[model samples]
Target: MKKNNTFFYLCTLLITVFLFITFTTIFSYFMLREGNKASAIKEFEVKEQEITLKTRDKLKIRVYRTKTKTIEEMDIEEYIKGVVAAEMPAEFNIEALKAQAVAARTYALAHMESVGGNGCGQINEGDICDTVHCQAYISKEDRFKAWPESKGNEYWSKIEEAVLKTKEEVIVYNNSIAKDIYYFAVSGGKTESSEEVFSQSVPYLQSVESTGEEVAPKFTSSLRYTNANFVKMINSYYPNSITSSSNLKNNIKIKNRTSAGGVKELQIGKTTITGTKFRSIMGLNSTNFSFVFNGNTVEIICKGYGHGVGMSQWGANSLGKNGKDYKYIISHYYKGVQIGKYTEL
Candidate 1:
């Protein structure tokens, strides 16, 4: 009987050891599975946080204030409102204002690396400046001060409506924001091709006829300067080349003209300067100019204003007044571009 009891005890001990081993293995498997699940959850949270941060950056714009020498960060849409108010005239048609809003929004996005750019850190760690160098921007208070007290509310409401209507809309070419969306006050009967004006070939900025720009206030301007003054001006640009009025008249000639009738190349003594450069130096309204030097006086006739490239604000206003919608206006100026909402960076 004692021998039987000993064998039974041995069997019981063996069963206990096997059960312990099995339980331990099962517990270890479950712990490893739980640990993996926790790791996956943590990774997902990190990805979610990264996306949120990116979205926040994309939604905001950093503006550099030139006067105050400071940086201001604000919502992109709000920034657009300020730009539209400052860039376009308050009396402009609502559709034209909307078009300006879209263009400004596209320009801002194109300059921001977080949104999609090489990064336009123009000033003070900001994406853009509040001057014409980037885009003219006025704060709410300044905008109010710019207009008459009675018209301030009305104009501000009008601009706000336009901006909100075209919120987040941008001009896109080939599934990306257009690199350049240039706009000027007026065109000289025709818009200039980008290659002619900026010396850069942009496929979307081809020359196109823009009528009704004659309605602009300064469509044509005449600058009368004495031969002595003309020579002085030219000499400022090309020093010591033109000593006398007769020398200036003899050396100054148009070497080449663009297809749109704007000056392409001009010869100033020995140096050949671009028509755009000449216009800038002479303070002419546009590159489409003609000069006549008659003995003692020189008179320069300039047509239109600004660079004469891209959309003409005056032309846009005319089209808008004629019942053309903003889409039609933008499409007419920018060739073969899609107006689409930006869904992502």
Candidate 2:
């Protein structure tokens, strides 16, 4: 009888063990499937790209990701001929493009979760739609394969070098590792400070004295309009002078308005103007803003693109199209800078 009971117990134990294994397997399979689905949604890369690290002001500059996947869809032969024909100087040998692809891939891998210019994690699409820090994808026509003709290049080796450290440096920028070396874009050929205008800092950047060119100093009213936002900007530098609740008739007036090309003509009170001169007055640049016009009210509009300082994006693209490489293009606008390996940092 005892022997029979032992056999019965053994059978029950084996059956329970087998059932447990079956249940666990099913659960694990479903869990893995869900995990893969999430990755497919959140993970993507710039096909065949490399990256470098840079620091500015107190902030570490994040690798600028192209929202347009120019690599994945590129037809090397056609792309090469298009660039060469445009009289834009580009070296399109199979080897060179392969190198670019390697570099691009390296950079993309390095920047998977890197920090941004604002000392925050790298932002994706829709984060800074109109801002220059992140490039926006204008259309589906944006995709271009990096190197379908050739595999890749030598630069891929360097992609991983500065990425991790570069991310670390960005945190420092947010915490004030480097003093902020902020600048105004063109200053509209001449410029002044909110401190000068309103006797305060206005939370804005410093202007580089005047360049005297009609297109030299780029000033923007991109973030400031109306009575409330204007007050915040003024108060950012000269808080005592501006009040957020004040209306136009009580504390604001349009002064010395000037108009510029290919932009909307705006009339608020007595003056007519174009460009970002309005932002300079209001103390915003691609970041924060507020505007209240008439009883109906209108939101602030950006007059000029970018920070409005030394170089313009459209200007750089034009130069690139007219025979300029990355180095020449970057240096022309930045002035007196070295594009060295980030490893030195």
CA lDDT of each prediction against the hidden true structure: 0.84, 0.35
Predicted candidate 1 versus true structure: per-residue lDDT over 1-345, tens digit per residue: 999999999999999999999999999999999999999986464223211114453588878888888878888899999998889898999999998998898888877656655445566477888888878899989999879999999999999999999877788777667879989888888999999888899988998989988878889998999988877887887897676666557878998988778999988777788888888888898999988877789889998888888899999999999999888888899998777777644
Best by lDDT: 1
Writing each residue's lDDT as its tens digit, candidate 2 over 1-345 gives 999999999999999999999999999999999999777654322111122434233322223235442223222222222222221112332222222222222222233233232321434421122122322222212222342334223322222222222222111112222212222233343233334333345332233333322331233453324556544554655546544354554444434332222222334343443325455454445321234566524456433433433334334444445566544543454333323222211
TM-score of 2: 0.28
Per-residue lDDT of 291 in model 1: 84
Whole-model lDDT for model 2 versus the true structure? Answer: 0.35
- Model 2 residue runs over 4 Å out of place are 1-119, 122-250, 254-303, 318-325, 342-345
TM-score on alpha carbons, each prediction: 0.81, 0.28
Cα error, residue 34 of model 2, in Å, equals: 67
